[model samples]
Target: MRRAAKADDNQPVIVKSFRQLGWTVAHTHMIGRGFPDTVVSKQLPSGLKFTAVIEIKDGAKPKSSQALTPDEVVWREAWQGEYKIINSIEAVLEYHDWVMKKF
Candidate 1:
């Protein structure tokens, strides 16, 4: 048997790993279709909360279509401009680690 692979097949796998690391993860499930796939936040012991928006893509060839859409761009610009385009689980964890040091 064969399986079909699309651009966002890894989102659930990455979300599961993110949850294991103590982040409160949420799927945008954007019915209107103008946002990132996931949003997550974690709190430090020092009472600092770090939140991030992540857009996920499959680690496949021709990475062009995975780029952020125009509306997603608007959302990032309105925020702290800390948006991430992720294709791997490690990148997601690394992003959290990078945010951890800031708090």
Candidate 2:
């Protein structure tokens, strides 16, 4: 059987949405030893800036291979600040709005 292909393409989609919303997104997420998949940043109108880490996963499948590893859990448990494990573009947009209210 042909495995799901586009399922692994969610990362680019998330990145694009973040860019559309005026946030700077990077594919190299070196934070916490590269536990996250993407790094996102934005400067609000008030000159307030914030950085966030996102871990993208394909939640469309019940048994998707995007589950976090043990290392990721350990890092996430110790890290601080904005972080999220997103599965869809809508979730990314929703989180963006939620984070915007913080600054």
Candidate 3:
């Protein structure tokens, strides 16, 4: 049987940070089966809204603890879309900056 989904220790902080930055965040951890943990959307200055999926890991944890599960690897490989793995608030800001530049 499949196990319950667990959010990384930093997930709440990341989600809150994203929301504070004016992005809409949806928690997707309950979806399980290697699906990303969150989906975030924001409207850029150019008035184009974009959505992206993210897998969150706690940067403070050991590398082994942060490693993706086999199902996650499979999901990532099979999915063809804008997906990112973020482990720190800095990475979140970087992603925001990158997305802002695309418009």
Candidate 4:
């Protein structure tokens, strides 16, 4: 299996890919909102706002042998807006598409 990516590595990759596609993105922690991994502002070419909280993680699927990590599960459950769990570029683009369609 591929090794998991550290936040240091994954964060920039996610940001760069989405920003290049024209989304306004930020690392959530940097904004003093200690919640998601990234915050994305989905916009139309005409600049309408479609925003959501996003969480990114690079890991194997959660193992049945172990219980959910409390902190991770808490954030996952408590998020109050459109949210997605993404691990690959396809998934990110899928999310952007879904946001555009929904909001």
Which candidate gets the maximum TM-score versus the true structure? Answer: 3
Cα lDDT of all candidates, in order? 0.73, 0.76, 0.92, 0.65
Tens digits of lDDT, candidate 4, 1-103: 5343235345677778788778888776443223567878865765678777766655344535223346557776876677776665777788777766765
Against the true structure, what is each candidate's TM-score? 0.76, 0.79, 0.94, 0.69
Runs of candidate 1 with Cα error greater than 4 angstroms are 1-7
lDDT for position 31 in model 4: 35
Candidate 4: segments with Cα more than 4 A from true spot: 1-8, 29-34, 45-47, 59-68
**61, model 2: CA deviation in Å?**
2.2
Give the TM-score (vs. native) of candidate 4. 0.69
Give lDDT tens digits, candidate 1, residues 1-103.
4333233778887888788888898887353245677887888778987787777877653677667668667766777745777788788778768777767
lDDT of 2 by residue, 55-82 (tens): 8787675654767768678878988978
Task: Choose 1 or 3, whichever is better by TM-score.
Answer: 3
| Candidate with the greatest lDDT versus the true structure | 3
What lDDT, from 0 to 1, does candidate 3 have?
A: 0.92
| Model with the higher TM-score, candidate 1 or 4 | 1
Worst lDDT run of 10 residues, candidate 1, spans 1-10
**10 residues in a row with least lDDT, candidate 2:** 1-10
Cα lDDT for residue 68, candidate 2:
73
Q: Tens-digit lDDT track for model 3 on 21-78? A: 8899999998999999999999888888899899999999998989999999999999
| Clash pairs for candidate 3 | none
